[model samples]
Target: MPRGEKSAYTDKQKRQAEHIEESEREQGRSKEDAERIAWATVNKQDGGGKKSGSGRAKPH
Candidate 1:
């Protein structure tokens, strides 16, 4: 994947990032910085979109 591309992320992950970004922005972060932090948080929580062979599992 290219830098900054988010095609591997799930819908819920995207939503989480959006919420995080908004929260960061409200706390005075720049848009770019907030987005970066948000994505990092989602990655930290979801392990970067890794999947099991069986099927989609429940979110923690």
Candidate 2:
């Protein structure tokens, strides 16, 4: 898939992912870990589809 392109996920899937992310954040993940999970599940790099936590980190 190209950058910015999207794949469909069920509403339940999305909600579940959001919950996971929120939980991770609440648990105090080093920003890097949080960004990775966001990208993996939501397809948004670094939480906003671009450099987050500086250019050193790549979304997972």
Candidate 3:
């Protein structure tokens, strides 16, 4: 559960991040910035990694 570790992310999420990163790079973002934006985007969409069993549900 280390910061910046992507092991908890699912394959689809990883692919989405990669695609987003590439798109960001195409739009003239730096490597680090693109990666940051990509992961942030994924986090916004998915609310973080889906592989973990705990904290996967939202309280009603």
Off by over 4 Å in 2: 1-7, 30-32, 38-60
| Worst-scoring 10-residue span by lDDT in model 3 | 51-60
Judged by lDDT against the true structure, how good is candidate 1? 0.90
- Which model, 1 or 2, shows the larger lDDT? 1
> Which pairs clash inside model 1?
none
Candidate 3 residue 1 Cα shift, in angstroms, is 1.2
Residue runs of model 1 more than 4 Å from their true location after superposition:
55-60
Winner on lDDT between 1 and 3 is 3
Candidate with better TM-score, 2 vs 3: 3
User: lDDT scores for all predictions?
Assistant: 0.90, 0.58, 0.93
- In the order shown, the candidates' Cα RMSDs to the true structure are 3.4, 11.7, 2.7
Leading candidate by lDDT: 3
**lDDT (tens digit, per residue) of candidate 2 on 26-47:** 9998667865675586544224
Taking all chains together, the TM-score of candidate 1 against the true structure is 0.82
lDDT string, candidate 1, 1-60, tens digits: 888889888888999999999999999999999999999999988889646578777676
